[model samples]
Target: MKKMSTDNKLISLLRQSYGTSNPQEAATFLSSAIGRVLKMEKEARRAHITEALKGVDLRRDAGGGMNSKPKTVYKDTKATQEKLAKLEATLQEMKAKYHALLNDGPQTAEENTRLKNRIAELQKSIENQKSQHFQELALLRQHSSNVANASELAALQQQLEDFQELSTQLSDECEQHKTRLKTLEATLEDKTAQVARLKKVMAEVAAGDEANETNVHQLELELANAQEALAVARKQNEEYNDKLLATLDSHLAANHEIDELNAKLVAALDFGQVFADEADHWKNAHDQKYADYEELQRRAEQTQTEVQSKYVDEHQRYKAASRKIDSIIEEKDGLHRQITHVRSLLKFEEQKSSDLTRQLSAARLEMTSMTDDLAQEKRVSELYAKNIRELHDQLALLKNRPVLPDWLFSGSMASGICFGLLFSFSADVAPAQRVLLGVCSGAVAFTVARIITKKNHQ
Candidate 1:
């Protein structure tokens, strides 16, 4: 009866929480919850009774420095939480790097402006050099025309000697510049190799991160499953606690009923004892009052038969009551065994819940680690992207920059120079004609070299 009242109160609370106008649905939910709650409580009581009876050993692990299983689980759970915190910290660092990568756009824009300025400066310098060379050529041509005065002729000769010396020095520098170009080419090759290695590493890291992401997702699903199981176990445990209370109430009520029955049986036995005593007194009184011996003896026999029959019925009734009590005791014993079995099952479930919770924590740690790794991979990939962009920009700038050192065009220019030298040395040709041919060939070679360079760049 008390259990029924408790169920009613619980149902009322649930109905309030449900807050539904449809009472029918609420009643249905109430019925289900009551049944579930009752079942859980009953199971839990049985389990506790089993533990009290020492029917099942809860500790499967006896190789123990630990006092109990729960303490060990607590220690492990605490350790896992600490590791999870560390993983979270690492993940935060990775997030910071990702943000940094996102902020690099402004820096790339600044680099573009710098490259543009450098290009403009190179163009201005090339124009200035061209104008200065043309002015010097004009002055040298005028000087070559007038050399009638000895002093002026001597000065002109000295100027020509200085120009020749400058040409020889420039050739020697060009030879040295060619050797430097070879070394620079080797260094550029090494840099390209390094860049290729970096690209390979980035690709591998990205692939590994992708794999870890998939693994973490699987772990998340498993963790969710474990959590659901744990919730179910907790609900069952609550139901068991409720059932234990209800069973204890029922047992107490049964004990009270047995006590009442025992009291009534004792009262009935006392009344039977008093009635037997009265019958004995009546026999003694009848004997003394009887005058005729034969008549008195017959009356006594008849009373004796009646008294014996009544006593036999009372004995049978007492035996039946005692048997019924014995049956109740046996039933109670059966209940105790069932309770013990339930306790074993409860312990098993508790162990399962603990293991599942531990696995869930481990999965969470793995997921956090995977997330951090993925972030790091993303940051690295972004860095690679930036480096690639800068490299492309540098390559474009190098291609467009003004050509340097006349020897850069030596292939075509050498052909022209050779033709000019051959024409200057020819016995059949006029000096002016040879000079004009040489100049035209030189112009042709320069044009051809420029065209080839442009085509190569394109």
Candidate 2:
């Protein structure tokens, strides 16, 4: 009944004092109550022992046990007492030994002072050695400085020598350059003179070409006049030959008629003696007409032969001229082929130029894209810089905030409050959203509390 009453009292006390909402606090309160009850019980048992000892019937019990040796109660009690005394003595000795061990450092104050003095002496000796070492280091540094100065001086001297050598080389180079300049200048003058000479030669050649062209023009005009005169002469010759052949054929026809007339007259005179003389005269006329006809035929044959020869000569000249014109046409065709090849080359070059232009445009586009990317990168870097600055300001503000008390953030109180808030939010929010907000709030609160506590401590 007492244990049950004590347990109920402990529960009531815990509920009233610490709010039993937190199990850990309730457990702590209960444990403290149990410790208090156990302590009170121990005091009550000691009080009972005192009262019982005062009213004990030691004599009666000894008399009753005397006949049968009383079951050796006193001996047992004495033995127990002795064992307890020995145990107590051993405990006291162990306590004393422990205290001695605990206080076993330096017993005498003077000895402690002497040890402190010795330590002080050692410290002083160490300090003196350190000072000596520092002094030696300073001396060594001075020696090293001297050596460094010597080395630096040597290096400077070497550099000076190198500078002098470089100066000499430069002077030599300058002299050579001056000589080369003079030589180049002379050569330039010569080349200039040669160029002038070439220009003069070109001018002379141009003059000669102009003169030759004028001469060729005059020759062409003369050739045209000669061709016109030859045409007129040929036409006149053909007209004269046609007129002469017509006249010769008419004379032959007239002579043949006269011969026929003379033959008829002779035959008429022979038929009468009185007309004999007239017959002879007619015969003579007939013979004369025959000779005239023979001459006319021979002249016609010579004229025909001359006309054939002239035609043959004119045909040979025309053939030669035609061959020359054909050769000129062949040359013109070759030039046309060369022109066509040149046109094809020009077209190819135009296509290549267009391709190059396209490539250039593509390269320009790529360059523009790269430039835009670089600009974007620069903007991002600027944004990052701004973010860093903002973060720095926020951190400073956090550092200046006030701290929360330990009791407020202790596991039981904070965990209970956090779980309650999480449950309440979870009812209104989605699971993922609740978790995210809970984690963010928890992290922010913890960080702010830490920063505030640190600031307050400082």
Top-TM-score candidate index: 2
lDDT of 2 by residue, 293-376 (tens): 677667766766666566566655555555655654565465456556555655655555555555555555555555555555
lDDT of each: 0.54, 0.56
How displaced is residue 153 in candidate 1, in Å? 4.6
Per-residue lDDT of candidate 1, residues 98-158 (tens digit): 6775564433556656744664464346446654664676456444433223344455455
For each candidate, how many residue pairs have backbone atoms clashing (under 3 Å)? Answer: 8, 1
Q: Against the hidden true structure, what lDDT does model 1 obtain?
A: 0.54
Q: Give the TM-score of candidate 2.
A: 0.35
